[model samples]
Target: HEAKINGLSITEVDFSTLSDDEAMLKVMMIDEPEKLSAAIAQLPASLYEQYNILQSAPFFLEFLHTDSHKGIGVKAIAQQFGINADEVICMGDAGNDKQMLEYAGLGVAMANASDDIKAIANHITASHNDDGVALVIEEFVLNK
Candidate 1:
């Protein structure tokens, strides 16, 4: 429905049913109702019930990630880039990117980023619509 509305192609994958290698590079899309429904159907009965309970709770999304997922994602990115986590620089304006930004050597937040994000960043550049990314690249990466 989203793709149809936006005039984009839509592909779906059920991650829970896929092998690790099969799922590794797949761009997981949770925005599609059909795909989400299919993925949810693959969960164990017990886990499914737990998911339902959590879904009804106020803190559902906040509690979704266990510590292991956090560590694994960071480790995987570091390994794939063949660089120490401290050597990387990251910039973003969302809550979900907080961990990645904190792990980077230079974590930059856009001028329009939330106060919380700015607090965690080493620097704050202009907003995306204002070419903040280019400014940062020119001043820090290119000039240096």
Candidate 2:
């Protein structure tokens, strides 16, 4: 309904009919910034136990699997590829990326990232709009 009011297109699904393999949950894009904050605040407490609530952006509230954090994925991939933890560099700016940032050998936070994120980051790069990730790649990966 919020998507309809905001003139956004989304697939409407009957959640009850979905099996575990068919669906995890729904994603909501709140167009209004103020309403986004309110919606996040009003999220039921029970949802936390079963899901990893992530606000990837100011208006996006992403509810993913509780065990599906980026840190775990990164670690698994590193092990699979025989890479050491100290050889991995991870970059992130959102609260949901906290775990991965901590797990990274060098955690990079964008200049526009929150203070908490910056505090945990090993390095602070430019904002995403200014090609922060690309810069990190150039400096770290390409050694340029």
Candidate 3:
């Protein structure tokens, strides 16, 4: 439904029946369709077309979700970087950063932050122009 709404072509992969060589070819096709096509031409006719369609569909989808409007992608990045949620610290001046601020072990809202965000943070720091991020990092992260 999402793909249909977005006008994207979708293909489903059934990994159970694919052989090792077929899987490898599929992966290669996804990464480099043109190159894979040239190479596949040298393979048997049945296998050539079998793997060609693999590259014709979208290879990746990006999803964004956040505790606050702006923090949606932040969680994904933290997970990708292998950073522990407890070890992370976040500071922000706007509502979008609210979720990131709350997710971190130490959440500092800018002195200029919205009241709602400030209320949810562990502390309030200086405004952005005053180097709020630097001040908090020095006082809590470095000095600690």
lDDT (10s digit) by residue, model 3, range 1-144: 445667967777777877766623123233344655465456666653343222222332111221223345667778899988787888876544666787787889888777777899999999998999899989988994
For all candidates in order, the CA lDDT equals: 0.61, 0.83, 0.63
**Candidate 2 lDDT by residue in tens digits, 65-131:** 7877889999999999999889999999987787799998999999888777899999999999999
Q: Best candidate, TM-score-wise?
A: 2
In terms of lDDT, model 1 sits at 0.61
Clashes of 1: 0
Error in Å for residue 61 of model 3: 26
Error of 2 at 2 (Å): 14
- List the candidate numbers ranked by TM-score, top first: 2, 1, 3
TM-score head-to-head 2 vs 3, winner: 2
Kindly list the per-residue Cα lDDT of model 1 for residues 30-138, writing each as its tens digit: 3444555465557667753432111211111222423323334775788897978777778777555566678888888888776777899999999989999999899
Candidate 1 vs candidate 2: the TM-score winner is 2
